[model samples]
Target: MFKVPPRPSTSRIPYAPLPNQGNDSGATPKASSPARSHRSSSGSCFETPVAAPSSSRRLSYAVNSGIKPSRPSSVSKGRSSIVAPAYSNLSSAKKPGEDPRPLKDKAYQADCIQNIYAFLESRGFDKPFDAGMLQLPSSKLFLKIFEFVMKQIDPRFKYGNKPEDDILDFVKGLHYPYNLSRSSLQQAGTPHTWPPLLAMLNWLVQTINFSDATSGPGTTAAQPAHLTPRRFEAGPLTNLTSETSPLDEEGCRAVFFEFMKESYNVFMNTEDETISDAKSQEMMQLFTTYFEEARQEVALDVENLKTELSRKEATLERMQDKSELKKLQEDKEILEKLLSDLIKETQRGEKDLQGYEEVLLDKQQELKKCAEITAGIQEDNALLCKRIQEQRFSKDDIEHMEEKLARRKAVLQMLKENRMHAGKEASKVEIQKVKIMEEIGQAAKKFNQRAAR
Candidate 1:
């Protein structure tokens, strides 16, 4: 506004400084000036509200506090206004060959070919890599990288920077490069030499072959500059051999050095053959001890089997004996039954004998009674004989006895007769006696009466 004079009317209106911008007079400016009829304007001048960082009062305050230096140039009021959208602080890809994916952009970095080559060349590119570097996390990755960059023209094997080239292109197209600014490509180790080295190889091979091929002016092989860079494939690793060319010397050096180092490490640290022999001896001793134990166990098992077989044979014998004894028991049972039958018969015979004895006793008893009867008859006969002897008289004796009795009776009769006869006589005699007594009594009485009288 110093170059172009401002109108007097501009001073009368209430002026406001635009967002974060102050007036030349160092005064607080606001948007209350209704019209900008004559304002000291520049490309940086903008009319924004107080609600933004563009607030006019805050710009005056910040300038007085020395929070920021004075603006050097002008601002355009009409440039594309990009209000920074609300966002979490995050890194983003800003280049053409950049990836848009999240988190991955942080993993690997992309760099221009120029910077990577400069750093590697300055290191003389011949130092044996620090062995400690290989033990680090991702160290093997660096090793794989460096291994890819070394090239060879061996027909028997394929080698070149093609693999690194491919990887570089991959990173350039896929990862964001800006965030890689903090990391020195040196941190990548020997592989940092890859891209420019590859480009140099391409240039070198082409220079040799191309210069020779195009040495004659009529031969024309140059193409349009827009043609893509020539591409080559990566090569396989190899051992040191006399056939390796001067160009191949570096590659052979790297490979053998790595291999020798590893072999040397193994030799120094590994066990010797004598130790191995001792281990083998110890194993043999253990095996011998176990073999003896196994032999004893097998012998014991054989003895046990023999004893078991004998026991089984004895059991079979016992079973046979039991079968024979069962037959014997059956036979004995039959004998016992026969014996019992014989005893029953004997008992019956004895009973019969007792009955016979009783009958005999009864017969004897009857015979004894008959004998007694016979004895009694004999006695009676004897008595009769005795009686006959005693009598000794027969019928004659009876007749004599009878004649005596008759005589007695006759005598009585005789006596009676006599008495009768005598009675006549006696009667006469008694009559005579009575007559005599009566006569005598009559005489005596007569006499006595006579006397008494």
Candidate 2:
């Protein structure tokens, strides 16, 4: 439902001669009557006012009076108070208003047209389009173009009885980014209302192009190359490879669906069995062509993948060998450094061991001397015991013997302290010697393991 402004009155309106609409003499037509002239002057008060062409009588009156009917100017200084009629049937007679919408840039329109045609051509659309088609497309041509575009988007999308409503619904469903009015789509045949439709189609074209580019083969979301449906494949037709051009999987599917639909319709509609048989043969031939093309494309892809895999495997083998060799060289250098450090440590240990050995020998000699002193003390005690047993004693002799015994005991205590100190020194020396031996043994074991490696 469209809301249109009221039509302006034509009474007392001026009739200005349009450019190149004058007589052969190049003279402007003058009003024959004073009333006509007065009316023309009175209409000049309004700025760029458009009057409805009421009937043929008004046009005849202007022609007989030698005054031309006014023609609307293509350009206007401001918003002209003229509006197109609501009904498309009266579109030719109606004057278009000064559109609030800005004109599309010519460069931008040309680019969009070019892109749309390029996309259509890529999709194998047979019909050609010029710039004029978008500028002032007929309803029939517009619908045809729309159907083609929608079919490209979805091969099985069928147009219903109200194609205009269907198209509007489909565009609305897509959430088209621009303003699209139902009125504009309803009167799509008119030049004044066709721009939005053209823009919508261009947008659809761009969307399809973007989707194809992003989701084509080799992308993560692309369909598997090898998944060709057997139902869509060629039947028993021969000479498959010679007849068809290469087709992608999607193309093959679309072609097969169309072929089947057409075949089914022909079979159901035709009363003649011979015609049905011929149509079936043609469908078979068409199917074989698409099937072969798709098959060839899949084969080529498989071969390319195989070659790529082999190349990668060869590269991996080379890299693995080089990496392993480099690792071995690094490990060998590490082992050599460890062996050199161990050798240095072994030499240091030997020096420390020699020093420890010398200390041990000194301790042993001290221990032996302490043992001899201990033995001498024991023998002296024995001799004193024997003397005590053999001789009677006076109190002065006994006191004298007690003093000697106390002095000997003091010597023996000094000897025992010396011996204990020597034993502690010996134990410390033994511990050091054992630690040195263990370290030497461990270093030797590591050196032997490295040699084996």
**Full-model lDDT for every candidate:** 0.37, 0.52
What is candidate 1's lDDT per residue for 172-278, written digit by digit as tens?
22211222311423344344433332232222222223222212221223322212121111111122233333224443333333322222222222245454334
| Per-candidate total of colliding backbone pairs | 13, 0
Once fitted onto the true fold, the runs of candidate 2 whose alpha carbons sit more than 4 angstroms away are: 1-103, 128-132, 217-453
lDDT of 2 by residue, 1-453 (tens): 101111113332123221223333322322221111011232221111122333333222211122112332221113221111111111112232333322355544555566566666666777767655666778887888888887655455555666666675555334343456668877886767765566567667655544343232212222233322223334322222223344745545534444433443453245566766665656656665655666888899999999999999998888689777899799999999999999999999999999999999999999999999999999999999999899877899999999999999999999999999999999999999999999999999999999999
Looking at model 2, residue 270 earns an lDDT score of 56
TM-score to true structure, per model: 0.15, 0.27
- Largest lDDT belongs to which candidate? 2
Model 2 whole-model lDDT (C-alpha atoms) = 0.52
